[model samples]
Target: MSYLVLARKYRPRRFEDMVGQEVVTGVLRGAIEDDRVGHAYLFAGPRGTGKTTTARILAKALNCVKGPTPDPCGECERCLASDEGAEFDVIEIDAASNTSVNDVRELRESVGYAPVDSRYKVYIVDEVHMLSRAAFNALLKTLEEPPSHVKFLFATTELHKVPDTILSRCQVMRLSPIREEQIAGRLATVFDAEGVTAADGVAAELARRARGGMRDALSLADQLLALAGNSPQLADLARLSGGAGLQELLGLVDALGAGDRAAALDAVAAWAGREGELAGALLDVVRSIVVAGVCGAGSPHLEGGPAAGEALLARAKALGRGRLELMLADLIRARERMRHLAGSERVVLESALLELCTLEATMSLAELEARLASLEARLGGASVAGHTAGPASGGQLPVSIQPTPPPVGASATRSVQQPTGPATGPATAPGAAPRSPDTPQPAPGPAAAPALEPWKALVGALDARHRTLADLLRRSGKLQGSGSMARILVSKASADEQALLADKRSRRACERALSGAMGREITVEFVVGDAATPPPPKVEQDPFTRQVADLFDGHIEEP
Candidate 1:
């Protein structure tokens, strides 16, 4: 007898045998038990996900010889015949091949008749979405209102292609892809039943490669078994799939995470030189890193040895979740581009590996913002100390000069008395002097100019420190007064300059400089005023004028 492939041998024989589709199974079971099964049912999902198989089981459950039982007894002739694909009452058609109006018309006509031997006539159309538009129109009425004795099961991977009109008439059951872990467990059972000795990691690897498809998993296992005689080792399975050993792949990831470009490039080059599957190797590495990140260290999901798994976990931690997600995206894009590139697989794989290795792990936006704040704080502090000093000449002061008391017994004391003559004002009390008519009395010696304040000192310091700023201050007539309360008359140009210096750091620096220059602390205050213009230039004699005078017979005197 020819050897039966794993896929066919492990096909679900009953509802209990179905995996990863408990919802659909339960609904169908309840329908069967309640005898409320719809006339037309549509099963839609991906390939190898048991759409066609479930259709067959449903047909058998309805057409069994005993009755329309929820659980068909396989011992009965009708059930046995249906399972073997030889039942006369159960008609299975490949819609992909028989998609014509004529075919649908014939099916419609046949549905009118009752079952010859079974309880109900069942028609299972696989890939029903492949049917032509005319075919769908021909069968629409029959599907919507089929005879009591006729049952229809339609399976399609592309449900969108099936018109909404047809979908509305049928009870649609959406089947999901089996989970990876469930697929692995099912494959392990198959391996045990087949007496195939698979290594520790082989079953899980095959299941992952299957991508939630049981048929594909079994097919992969069959090929491995064929290649390795009977007892397939993990290495053999990996070799057949063109995947690298988990340890090697993890090592590559570790190098990348550590930012060791050389090591990463070397590993990739070595893998590329080998005549194995570069794409598979790349995917395997990405998958292992992702799994490690999700599952944490010592996860059983990793196919490699414990050390390799631990390494991958470490790399995942170092690279972080954000980096790992970006790497996955880049790998997927590279894989797609590789198909179109006309170069050696090694070159393509190396390019992708190098890119991954050089990937700079990015911080979260929050973290970046925190860092920026820290930098700004440090800069502010430094600017306060280094950039905020008063001018070399010290800051301006508000002059309010008080006359020094006259030396004991001198006539200068009489000068403090008010003038009595017409040329001067009436005599005032001692220490109170009246203004002289001709001299205006100098306003009590300029009110003894006020002491210089800290802010003025700081501005002075800034002017001394920055030449450009000093030039700007001089040009704008910002320099004013001679004491603490001295105001820097700010013209429009100086106001614009002040606006430029309005940043928090710059303002703080100026404050610090002012504080240092003045004995007391001070703050900045702006006042607007028109700037004083410079007088017209006057012509002056040069050194050449004296030299010409010495050369001539006459002296060069001022005109």
Candidate 2:
């Protein structure tokens, strides 16, 4: 005897045996039990999702010798006939082959005839949407008012193709795709029944590859069992599904995380010549990584199971949420672009992958923000050595802060603690004994004046008269000093700022603004000394940046 495939051998014999479609089955079961079974019913959903199977089971339930029962007795002749697809009262038609008006007319004529032996004549039409417009029109009246003994069951993947006239008469029951876990569980049952010893992840991998089709999963399992015999390896399942092994997918992600371009490229190159859908496999693995990152390592969506979660969680964390989002976007775009581009799939896919691996070369806004956030956290807790704490030269309380010079063996806490008086009282004279708090306070110096808080007022005073000079003075240095002598330090200023401030006119306007603001003659001196603001230090490149620069044959440019 020829062997029956698992899809057929394990076909659901009753409504209770159906998977992932509780609502549809429950409604049908209730309808039969309540004796309110509709004369015409429409079962619509994707292929291999039990639309046709449900139709057969419904037919058996209506035609069983015991009665029109919700549960069919399989031992009954009518139930056995329905199971073998040879019931005289249950007519199964393929609308694809017989789509003409004549075929539909014949069907209408047959509906008037009584059941040969069962309780009702059941017409099960697969792909019922394929019927021509003329065929649908010819059958519309008969479908609306079929013989009381005749029950119609229509199954179609494309529901929209069926005419409204036909659909309005039928009780539409939509079936859903089976869940991955459900499919995997069923496959495990198949493995036990078939006496097969499969790897732990093999059934799960097959179920995922089924894309929510129980029949497809069972068929794949059967194919793998035939090819690999009773003991099927994980590699056999991987080969059957046209997906890379879990370890290979993990290795590629690891290469990306470590910025190992050669390794990443080698992995891609290895799959370039393979028969399987490499892009799809990579997409699935990447999707799992992203889901694991967002929902955590325990997410049920991780296709490779715990090993995948453990292997990819660190890499996901390392890539960060933003970079991972961009990578996923790039991957999706590459897949879409490949659909239209023939012979360029490898080049496009590899280029996109390389870009992800070397993301620093083109940091997205999110990636830049992520980098800045990390830097900010590190800087917030940082300490400087010998950092000075002094008021601005203008007696301006503190428009800007300066880092103290490193004092040997001591970390300096830079504070913006400004005194109500000048010079913080002479800086304690380098090594003099600390002054007693009760010691008489010194009188105000000639340069000491009430602090000018709004530096913009001083700058704006000259803005109307000398906009360029105002801009230069504004850009040139951190202001300090007070009445009669306003100092503008120029050492750390940019070359252009220094040159602009050095001009005689710009200096005179700055002096005028300072004097006006102080309500006294303020001599502005542009000084260069230890007190001058220091130029910003060059930022050291991180390894991620270095790797990106190396990959792109580029260097970091200063802004």
Candidate 3:
């Protein structure tokens, strides 16, 4: 086996050869030049961010026969051996394989020896986090105060696992994840060196797939080279990665935006066995959509090609910020749930996507508030759809969902009562509509003409927004009330409609709709009864009552 993989072949030999680690490499170079080098250094960061490589480079620099210069003469026998991690004096210890007290004792015993031939005996410990507690305790004395001739260099992906005493002895240098641009640039250089032709975007795509690890990027590139031979493309990268393609994810987003659940599910079926990947990729697309909604395309920066980013922006604008955020949250939650939930990951992911696609046109919180304000203003002068709700005196139905005091003589249902207060609310003009129930007001005077059909107006208003809910409510109950309170008398038989409104999210949407129709803040209480409002049965609750109780976190009681 004469072939060397690109990761080993291109390992950085000198500090300058490292990529995306200038802060760390710069500090080490400065330390070497100023001779302020510490006895022990702990390199901490994610794997493949050059922890071991940087430590090795530091060893080579210190042991170089060129008078301890930062730039080692690669031609020197010691420097060459250090580069290959074969230098007898510069020992490389993999703590993972030697995580025992005996191993540390052996290391401690050897630390007293003088450098075989190099200027200093460098002990490079990789994955030092894997050392057992006993091993760590045994090595503490040596790590704290090694001989003046010895240098200790440690590297770990999990810095927290290293004990504090051990940490205090070492000058810990935190290495950050490599940036995508730097990784891509490194990949391009490697490809150029290997005489391989690749698509313009192939390097960048591979870099992104690395997720901030130079070694990972190179490893992915090696796979790409093996599959495509000498001329790799983005398609090869996508297939080899086992992740959902951008276009497929985009199609899923498009279907979600269009409220096409089947289409969205169909679009994601290609990655059924790879639900984690599909969900993760969809999360990225939704995040981009959210970013595009907040800012323009490539506002902060761009990751993919221009066309893809612009398309994301267009889809974001079409989907609107509210829906994009909801979808983003859903995707994130689904991805997290996939980690713990049993059965097929596809089931968890697809259910979430389906739920998102079912979302009706939603407005941002700001927009919802603004629309409510505008509706109140409109109520001051005109009836909604030319109709106003009659006082509770009329034979109309009762409809209430807001959290207000229980109706007079009503004790079966639990309600969060507003503390009683004076009529601080401004007096309603001879014929003005109320603005809010924040302050309870006197019931409106009896209508001169038969109370105009306000329920009609309410249904009509909601029809434009939540057609399904509004239609169900129209058949299941009727809105009736005035001043500070409104009630919907729901027929006990309309269980389907009752269940729909009982949903936590659906209830909120319905409330928003009702608020607009009423022109003021509405305290809606749904009375699940007809003419003879009987007391609730407390002994044996029905499924509908149980569900409502669960949704509201309340219980039923007899009057």
Per residue, candidate 1 scores C-alpha lDDT tens digits across 1-559 of 9988988888897888999999999999999999899998999988889998998899998888765777889999988898788889989999999999999999998998889888889999999999999999999989777888888999999999999999999999999988877888898898788787777877877776666678888888888888997688877865664345556666677666554545755665555445235555656677777898899767877754576677777777767787788778877766766667645444455545545644544555464445444434533443222223333344322222233222222222121111121222123222222112223222221112322233233334444223333344444423222222222333433222332232223233343444344433333322233223221122211212222222232211221
TM-score, cand. 2 vs. native:
0.57
Candidate 1 has a TM-score of 0.55
lDDT, candidate 1, equals 0.62
What TM-score does each of the candidates earn? Answer: 0.55, 0.57, 0.66
Instruction: Per model, state how many residue pairs clash.
Output: 27, 7, 13
Candidate 2 structure quality by residue, lDDT tens digits, 1-559: 8999999999999888998999999999999889999989999998899998999999999888886788999989999988998898889999999999999999998888888888899898999999999999998989867889999999999999999999999999998878888888888988898888888888887887776789888888888988899888887765664456667777887666554545766776666644126676677777777888888887877665777677778767766766677667877887887777776665556555655554432334454345444434543453322213222222222232222112111111111111212333242321111122233322333443332322444555444434444454455444545334444443233322333343444555565555554556555545432233332223212222223333333221221
The model with the greater lDDT, 2 or 3, is 3
Best by lDDT: 3
- Local distance difference test, per candidate? 0.62, 0.66, 0.68
lDDT of 2 at 480: 48
lDDT of 3 by residue, 1-559 (tens): 7878899999999999999999999999999999989999999998789999999999999988885878989989988898777899988899999999999999999999898898999999999999999999998989777899999999999999999999999999999989878898999999999999998998987776676789988888888888888998777776675445567677788777654645766755666567786776678778867777677787655566677679888987787776777777888888888889765466566557655754555766676666555544644553322223532223232433223242333333221112122332335421122122243433542211112334544554454445555655655554445443444544443333444444444445544555555555544445444323344456313433434443233211221
